[model samples]
Target: MAITNNRMICRTVFAATLLTAPFQIFTSAIGQVYPSLTLLFALMLFLFYDVSKVLKTSLTMKTWAALVLVQIISLLWAVDIREGIREIVYSFSFFLVFGASMQESKRNLRSLTLLIIAYSVLTLSQSTLVIYFRLIPDVKIQYLQGHLAEIFTSPNTLIDLFGSERNNVLDEAKSGGFEVNANTGAAWVGMVGMVTMGLAIGLRRKLLFFVSLFHLVAVFFSGSKAASLLVCCLLALMYLTVYISKKFTPSRFAILISFVVLLTVAGSIVVAAGSATDFGQASSDTLDTRKLIWAHAAVEFLKHPILGQGFGGWSETFQAYAWRQKISDGYPPHDTLIRLWSQSGLIAALVGAAFMIAFSVEVLTLVRSGSRTAAWIGAGIWCGFLFVSIQGLGENWGLLGTLRMSPFIAACFALSRALGYYTSPATRSSVLNTSVRQIKYV
Candidate 1:
């Protein structure tokens, strides 16, 4: 498929918007903003962008069914009218804009790759700026959030409302670096780490490798075990997926498989090698606390198996359930399935999971069956998203009132749409007016 002039321009603007605006709006004045400003850019692109190309296929039978089911169930369970609509629109918009991006432009890919680099470098610049102004110490310059204890615990968790003796207890074990919010800072670094890895694979640039190395260094400070594990898991998954898919129709699969395997394995090993020093060891107590929370959340799922007590009520429900069990950290289950079941019920979980599964399969098909640009973007967004989804299972990023929809999450959904996964390849061909038939994202 030919890279059209229009696609290039649109993607350039989109990538730039993501890289720049978030920093200015959220990170400009204060330490670090809650609910990262990238969310704003994602909404801007989804809501205002000229993306009718995706809309035509968006009303497909599958999407429509999922939307209707969620909406109906939401009406019954989604107590907050505005929040429910936002969630549904968020889910829908992710599909619509990305679905239209199927005709990938090399220019756009180049633009995206560059934008990622810019985002990564901002770490150095941000740190320098912080030190220069004495906003933070040279060594203590926060990577993502401001406070050190906030890195390990939520500063504004509102635990006081629960009447617990230890309300919003910040982890005092600042044995090493800055005390930024672990979820926000570390998760962001881990995500950027994955992005760099993906770009290194698709672009094969010397710069991407160094960029990846640097991002992992930042990840070291995040002290988020789940986020670190998540990056490795996604990279491993990507190489495996690429290898298994390449074995088929594309005879070039062997060479590509070998290449990806070598890169992924070697990269992981290198990252792990220094991890002994780079990554601080977590106490057994911390590990135990996480397990305890997860375990308690699991039990709540079984008790209220269906018809969760509506959106935004997870806390009220979680608190009520936890109080019975007497393990009162006041944490809503960090796991996605548990929180999802407790809030939206099985049906909502089913629809969301279906979209994810379908998106992954479609992405694989599109990449394996089509041009390089589309394949890279398709694979990049899909793998990046899957990495987060795996983490989301153990974290509460998408649990309604927590962090809202992630920009990275929205990007993955949008990229999937652009790969034209929702509509058949034939439909995309007709739009681009090209004979380049999409086989599937291999």
Candidate 2:
């Protein structure tokens, strides 16, 4: 009876986590202290579960652990040790929860599908609400209800009501959703939306198709160029996955060759475009903002090179350089790869890179497996996560900060791994056959 009771409680908590993920907007819409109830519940679950399970299942997670250890060691030399410690704690807590909570089963897959749809809906709704306010200038519920109601208004409205007086909490624009900034909103959409797209294709769930479309609309409304591009890339990748599944036998050589060719073409195009313009040209200056930030970051990385100036030191170092160059401080270089190299040194950066490589390989292995449903889903997540990671080249907040989406990405990968095992060779044929019948019925 006690074991049964425990099982029931675990199921309830997991379900609650999925449900709570969508409602996070309600708190963010208001000026509530606990912003992400989903993350909070996730953290609670992480603490309550067995710690050993994290290492036993996911190979990617073991690499992640090494990355964390590197970061912890860097804290010894960090100028702001307190901030460095906080960063470590935040990372550890997130991975711990994610590792503990995710499972491999049909029931969990269904739950994940629901969670993705809910999250996408919430983001779309938030963006839509903001757009509505923008279109209808006279939607003055706040002014009619007095100063207190100003807090109840959307971030954009609050900015209009209080102007510069708006607190950081109230400082939102339509570019972001429930996240702190427009960029964060767009980043989350890119990562989570990609995961959803993968799961949808893998499960062959018709509902997810529409949900993904809605997610794209939300990403578009968020006004993130990186995110917009990521969504387009995700669609292209999904199409490619389906095409390959139909035409090819999911061979590693074919997939690798195709990926290499695609990347080469894309890289060549970017390089050609950049080389066509002079550095001092108008086109260059518009793009040079990020380049300049990166240039400054590169210099900082060189100065420290090995152990680095330590966590939070890159920004300080960049600020000093920016002041000399008559540019502003407080804004990062908008690149996670370089930021890691600058802040944590080559060791930490190598660890991070290893994690990415390991995770990608694992997903690819799943894709090449006999499990058709698992393969498509794994492909979706791998492609989606790749899009987000590529987009991170220009947008640093996708990882290792308050705006980080890496944990969720990890969780999705873990889910894919779990689902891959659940749908083995013997069972996959049966599952696909049943799915075909069900589709025919519908």
Candidate 3:
């Protein structure tokens, strides 16, 4: 009875974290506490109950360990050793808490999908209250103490919270729900929004599919143009995945994915060529700024080519190089791949690339499998990752220090292990039989 109760409590805590982990508003309300209290407590419970199992069966353990080691070794070249060490500790801790807690199974995947949808609903409701009724907390902005004023007394502060800087559409008082910046909220919503849509279609829940559209409205309210564009692209991809799953063979689906990727790249190049120097409009200005940042980053990478400036070297490197570029120090290279390459150099970039490729291959395998449920979950996770990576080209959401996006990434990868669990002989046979029957009826 005691063991059973403990197991139940463990599962409950894990479920709660899944629902609340992506929203920045929750983290802000809790005073910027990282990894969350629930995560820590659950880590303890996991240690007590399933430590051996977690260590033995975990797919990401070795890769995470290698990544951690790379960061630790890079500290030798890091100008800011203290910050570098802090990053190392953070990655290791996240591995222990989030990376270990994941179990590869269809049950857990479905639960995670539901929790993501719930997170979307909660965020949308919070934003709606702030937008319609001027309801926002009167507490201090814990995350932005120095950059922003300590206390938010008026509705203007609340409006600023939702990233009104780039948000021309929403009213000034639009709150960012749990996140301090509206852009981050938009990015968070965009990722989960894709998941909700994918899950709805995968599970044949028509009402859930329609209801999930509200999340896009929430993203628009966030007022981050980057997020808005990314969500639009992801929504198209989400629908495409559904259509392809129903109509195409596995080999054709793979070809379609490749073709779409090439087409997206070609379109982006054409757009960039058309507006390469237009600094008047927002979209063009953003593109121009990223190009400049990437240029600067490439120059910096040449300075310390092998290991680069090391982990958490962004500010220090920027401080040294900003005078040359005539820009402020806080403006990081604005690209995740460029930032990693410039900071940790070639080795770190390779590690990051390998990690992403492994993750992508795993997700793709699941999509190509005959199981519809597994395919939907895989496509959702894959698309969410692609959105973040695309966003990273214009911003640094996926960087190591950005804890805001970390939990969401962790959730996707953790749930992705469902491929192995759901592809057993019995499950595959059942899925195959169902597919054949449906085709016959058609």
Q: What overall lDDT, based on C-alpha atoms, would model 2 receive against the true structure? A: 0.58
lDDT of 2 by residue, 218-311 (tens): 7766545445555665667665664554334537436754764585456445545766554224234435677788788777777777886787
Candidate numbers sorted by TM-score from highest down: 2, 3, 1
Off by over 4 Å in 1: 1-17, 20-47, 50-180, 248-303, 321-329, 370-380, 399-405, 409-442
lDDT of 1 at 427: 62
Q: Which candidate gets the maximum lDDT versus the true structure?
A: 2
TM per prediction: 0.63, 0.76, 0.74
Give each model's whole-structure lDDT: 0.48, 0.58, 0.56
Candidates 1 and 3 compared by TM-score, better number: 3
lDDT of 2 at 360: 76
Candidate ordering by lDDT (highest first): 2, 3, 1
C-alpha positional error of residue 199 in candidate 3 after TM-score superposition, expressed in Å: 0.7
Cα deviation at 167, candidate 2, in Å, is: 14
Could you tell me the TM-score of candidate 2? 0.76
lDDT of 3: 0.56
Clashing pairs in 3: 24-178, 24-179, 25-178, 25-179
Q: How many backbone overlaps does candidate 3 show?
A: 4
